[model samples]
Every structure is written in C-alpha cells, then in structure tokens.
Target: MPHDHQNDEPLSSSGHPFRADDDTKLSYWQVMEIAVRELLIEKGHISASQVHEQINRMDARSPANGATIVARAWTDPQFKAALLTNAGQTSRDMGFDIGPMQLIVVENTNSVHNVVVCTLCSCYPRNLLGLPPDWYKSRAYRSRTVVEPRKVLSEFGVEIAPDVQVRVHDSTADMRYLVLPAKPAEANGVSETLLANWVTRDSMIGVGLPRAPV
Candidate 1:
C-alpha cells in the first residue's frame, strides 16, 4: 500500500531523466537562487569571491567528512558522546559548515537499526553526505521504505535479524538525520583514516554495513 503507482507517468511516454543541479534547463527555484545571489553581489551585499568560496565549500563536502566523524566516534568516546548529544555543533566543531541545517544522529546497536527516508520529498543531509544517489529519490523508495523497511533493506544486501528492530526516520527541510553505524570488531586500534575507509555512504544512510577491514 505504501508504494502506489497511481501517480506514475504513462508507460507510453518516456519520463525525463533526473536533472543535476547545474543541468542546462534550470528549475524555477534554481533560477531564483541564481538571481538572488547575483542581486546580492551587484548590491555589494556579498562578494563574488565569497559566493565562489561558499560554492566550493559545498562542493567539497562528501561522505568522507561523515566518515571522519564516525571514525573518530569509534575511537573516542567523548567525541562520540558529544556527537550524539549535539550533532550540529559537533560537526561544526569538526570544521564542517552545516549552515542552518539541524542534524540529528541515530545510533545503530545490536538490537536496533535506524534508516532514513523522506516520504514527502528528497530532503537529506547533503552538507555531510554530498549529493544523494538517484535511487534515493525514487517514488518506490520514498513510499515503501516506511511500510516494508526489512524488505527494502534486504534489497540493499543488509540482513537484519528478526530480533532486531528497524526504525525509520523521516527527514524534513529543517531537520536531517545520519546513522552512526556500529564499529567493526576488527577495527580496534585501527587508525582513523583506515577506519574511515570502511565507512560507506550507504552505511551512513542505513542501507548497508561498514566494510570489513582488509
């Protein structure tokens, strides 16, 4: 029932591909953003250099930043506590510009797993995880994840034990979430950089597990 194709496009018509933020055809909102930015620049309210720097900063953000945080949490209890208590501030303390977005971190324990979804739209913590995968924005994923989480996660190759609970968190424009994956047993005493390598984007999204140490 969660996934209904009632609103699907006609099979006779091929749908347009997903458009990138910088695609040739701009959305109304995208055009507005550009216009507002340029107006601010022309009015001396902001500088082009500052705009470029901000764009570069956003472009530089990736899952790597989140991996670093998870790795540190695995190695340092105090930081992990801080991260769980106040993710937005902790991320800022780690030098990530999360802007005005409110971030909430959920922990994956032996008895429970946390998954993220945006039933209404594709709201995500892009500041920490960069661009979302194309599949994440699909109607099926958005609708079915909340209804049949176990089946959905299994499709991603994640097997959750029957005894374990699956909790789905819905993201919104003002609030976002990140999953703090459980640390691997073999990761003890591993360097943060090496541990970071085990953290994948899907793991942070709760669709996959951390890679085993190799």
Candidate 2:
C-alpha cells in the first residue's frame, strides 16, 4: 500500500490540536518519538496504555469536584476552619484525596490579610488546584501581584479597604496557595451549590472572591 506519509502524519491522524510540521528540526524529534512510542506499544514496552483516557476523564470531572468542595467549605464553619488551617486537609476531608503539594489557605479577615505570588518561580499547588492559568505564571502577574496586590485585585473586580495589609507570598517551591476570602454579607445561608458557583478561580488566587447574586 502506497501510504500517504503527509496524510497519516500527526499522532495517528490529522485535526490534532497541534500539527506535526515535517520541515522543522522538531520533525526529527517528532518522528523519532512517534516511532519509539508506537514500537513500545506494539512490543509491550508499556502495559495497557489507557492513562491518556483516564486523564481525559479526570479533567472532564474536575468542575464537579471543585463545585462540591466549594459548597461544603461555604456552609460548614468547622470545615472552613479546616480549610484555612490546611487547605490540603480540607480537600481530603471531603473524601477527595489530593495527592500532594499540600495546599495551605490563608484567610483575609478584618485584621489579617494575604496576597499570593510566585517570585522565584511559579510553584502553584497542583493537587488542590489543578493548574494555574497562563496569566498567573506570567512575569506581569508575578511582578505586580507582590507590588500592588490591591490594584491588581481591583482589575478582577475586588475592592479592598485602605487599612488592610496585603501580605504577598513568594511561591518558590511546589506549594501553592488559595485565599479563603471573607464571605460576602449578602450570601449568608446560600445553598452550597449556588455558593460554589460563585467561587471563581480568580477568587482562590486571592485576586477575587465569590459574590452574592445580583
């Protein structure tokens, strides 16, 4: 069979999100990788390789897990305490085992304050928080998150009192952080699911927090 090399190129098909350019230097590495991987699969160099599928399924189910976690924290006082003390423990208490990178949450209350940053490098907590967005890791975020957290937070629609001290953290290791922002006064007794919907990723990053529905 005269196989069309170009047609049957990237990862067993076309329409892959990334294209395999044959002309570039990367093509050599790509071809080598493809050949080695296929051979490994054929020769049982690896066992049943269903990891990709499992990973896909895990990603698909992330929002539900996040929602469940968010709701419980909002409704339960003790649970919220646990989350503030140790974010990793809070995730586990909910029957969801966060692997590692034990997350520690800080609360922004009347007197105490907190801000999250990645100074040396971005070492976000991947267990409790899957992955930080592109912007979180950007130089701009790292630079500004520490200097003027309130200003940046305002961009995300959070307003801070002038008296509060913004304590910025340097994420130098694998440890990540999230902020247990003060519950909006209007959201008291809100359903867990509804409250969870209000908790946005930006809130966890300490840039923003959930709000009562308008």
Candidate 3:
C-alpha cells in the first residue's frame, strides 16, 4: 500500500523543497526514459560504461566528414557521379557509415537551389554530417522552410536570384538528404583540403551557401 503524501513537500534533485507546480518542461516520455535508464543502471541490468562508449562514438562524428565528401565531389567528376548515384556506398567507400537509411544527394545548379527539412522530426544524415543544429530541429524551421523556402534561406543570409527556383526536400526515416552546394567560381583552382574549408554544415543542409575563399 502507498502512503498518502498529499500534504508532504516534494524535493528536487538538489534536495531543495520544490513546488509541485514548478515547470520542468520535460515531456512525459522524456521523464519516463530518464527514470527507466536510471532504474536499469541501478539494477545492473545495463552497464553505464556501455552507454558512455556509445555516446562517445556519436560525439566523434562531425561536419568535417561531410565537408570532405563535398570537397571530393567538387574536384572529381567521376566521384561526384558515384556519390549522386549511391551516396551510402560512396560514403562507405570513403570510410563513413550512413546507416541503413538511403542518402540522396541533391545538386544545387544555376537554375535551382535545394533545401532539406524534416517536417515530422529531425531525420538528418547524422552519421556523415554529425548532429543536427538546434534551429534545424525547431518547429518554425521545419514548418516554414517547406512553405516559404526562399524566405527561410534569406533569413540565413542566403539570397537566391529571382530567376533561380527554390526546391525543398522533406527527409524521412527511410531516406535522408545532403545538399551538394555548387563550387564557387573562385574555388576552381583550390586544393581539395582547402576547398573542404568552404563547405559548412548549414550549406550541406541547404539553409546557407558555402563561404567564399578570402
């Protein structure tokens, strides 16, 4: 039988008495996940070391992986063809794992610009491009990008010409996307290593363009 604690005060993690009305803002599922994980750890059902190792693996991934691939594509037309044809295999060939999901690489051309968004949730190419940024997972960005892509791009300081068309791609659980930003004219003679510096996470997401070499 449970004791009645209607009149008893609740304490936070810090042992400070807290009001029940305090807003932690965590969802029911999120709170439950934390509770379950803690309980499992306490019971020795799962090792904390295993959890930390997985976390470290995730943290190891970064935007530089995607930048290298983009730079290679810019320099090697044959590699570009292979990447466009099969991004997952191409990524594997380059020592990156894109998981089981299919990766679709969209090329930005003179006539068109492409942007990617996941309206439901942030289904990004995390294995290749690291974690998604905060704004990429926001509701405003997910909703507005599809509706008014040009306006969204403008907010990111990307101004497309009036004649160019803006195409927005919705990523899903089964498929992910990466934008192949057009190589800057000035980057023609740039070395692959140096060109990789021009590719940014936002540019790969299609929110912004790559920085021009100074």
Candidate 4:
C-alpha cells in the first residue's frame, strides 16, 4: 500500500488495502496497517521496490598492507620504530584499522629483534587482512614456527642475515599481530602501492620477508 509516509503510516506490501479482523482488538490504525499489507500480498500491490544495496561493506586495504607498512618503516626509521612500538595506532595512520584486535608491535632488537608465534594458537589480525591462512593455524606451522622460525623461513626460501637479531612473539588472548618485516636495504624510495605487492602474509609472520626484486 502506498505509505502515506508523510503521516508515518507503516507501509503495506507496496499498495495493498488495509485489513482488520472483526474480533481482533488491535487499534484501528494498527489493524489498517496489517490489512494493507495482507491485501498487498493477496493482490500483487505495486511491486515492492527492491532496496538495492551493496554487501561488501568492509574496507580492507590489502594483505600487502603489512608490507607497505614495513616498507614505509625501512625508508623511514622513526616511522618504523613507531610501527614497531605501537602497531595499532601506526596501522590506523597508514589507513588501516587494527585497533579492534588491540594491536601490539614488538620490535627486533640487537640480541632479539622479534618474530611472532601463536605458540598456543593462531591468532592473527583479521581486520587488516582476512582469515589466517590454514598453514598459520596448523600444528605443523605453529609448533615448529616458534622453535625455528629461521629454518622455516629458509625452507620457504627466506634467509635472515645471521648477524641480525630475531625475537619471537607469541600472540594470544587480547592481542593480535602483524609483522614489521624488516625492510629490504634496496627498497629505497619505493611507493606504498608498489611496496605492498612485495609484502605477503607469510613474510609478515617471519616465514618470509617481502620478495626482494621480482
């Protein structure tokens, strides 16, 4: 029924006449609304306007958002430290949202720059990317990832410099994580878009670093 939206009347299915049961005690206005909708259905009242809308409402920057961030850090040490020190706010600064996961950034240090392990489980930052890949959650990866991240990275073909420190992080409870994968020395003056392509979910986890050239 044509909603006299002006009066704020509840619309019936398109344009059905209002119907009211004889014995029902609903107020006249309420009964009319029910009747109108019933009539609309009984007779094809005007076609219900399909309220077209989009469902892919989430704004995911990219899986490479991690890479882009790390790349940004490599080029700018202070920004890198900010990212390493505060993953949540810096992520928001880079046009990504990691606040809900209660992000915490752990930096690599002289003796132990960090690498992460959901040693007990696979808790990852889904808002920035999507679901954790199966391997990240698997016992094989989780159990072995912490014990020997460098070895795993090597098999995946990632060879961390022996001289550089490698700290390990275990994500659990309130915190979720993304890696501040150390920037490549050669990635000088790289654009965020181009740099992101090099970033991969695995690289962020220290199983790999963004690919160097190709």
lDDT of 4: 0.68
Rank candidates by TM-score, best first.
Answer: 3, 1, 2, 4
- What TM-score does candidate 1 reach? 0.80
Cα lDDT, all candidates: 0.90, 0.70, 0.89, 0.68
TM-score of each: 0.80, 0.72, 0.81, 0.62
Residue pairs clashing, model 3: none
Ordered list by lDDT, greatest first: 1, 3, 2, 4
Task: Give the alpha carbon lDDT tens digit for every residue of 1-214 in model 1.
Answer: 4333466444323444333456478889999999999999999999999989988888888999899999999999999999999999999999988888799999999999999999999988998888899999999999999999999999999999999999999885678999999998877788988999999999999999999746
How accurate locally is residue 105 in candidate 3, as Cα lDDT from 0 to 100?
93
Error of 4 at 150 (Å): 3.4
Candidate 1: which stretches are off by over 4 Å? Answer: 1-34
Worst 10 residues of 3 by lDDT: 1-10
Q: Cα miss at 75, model 1 (Å)?
A: 1.1
Query: Which has the higher TM-score value, candidate number 2 or candidate number 3?
Result: 3
Q: List residue ranges in candidate 3 displaced over 4 A.
A: 1-27, 35-46
Residue 1, model 4: Cα distance from true site in angstroms? 65
In candidate 1 the C-alpha lDDT for residue 30 amounts to: 90
Query: Across residues 28-65, which tens digit of lDDT does each residue of candidate 2 receive?
Result: 88889778877877888774456466566446544345
Candidate 4 accuracy as TM-score: 0.62
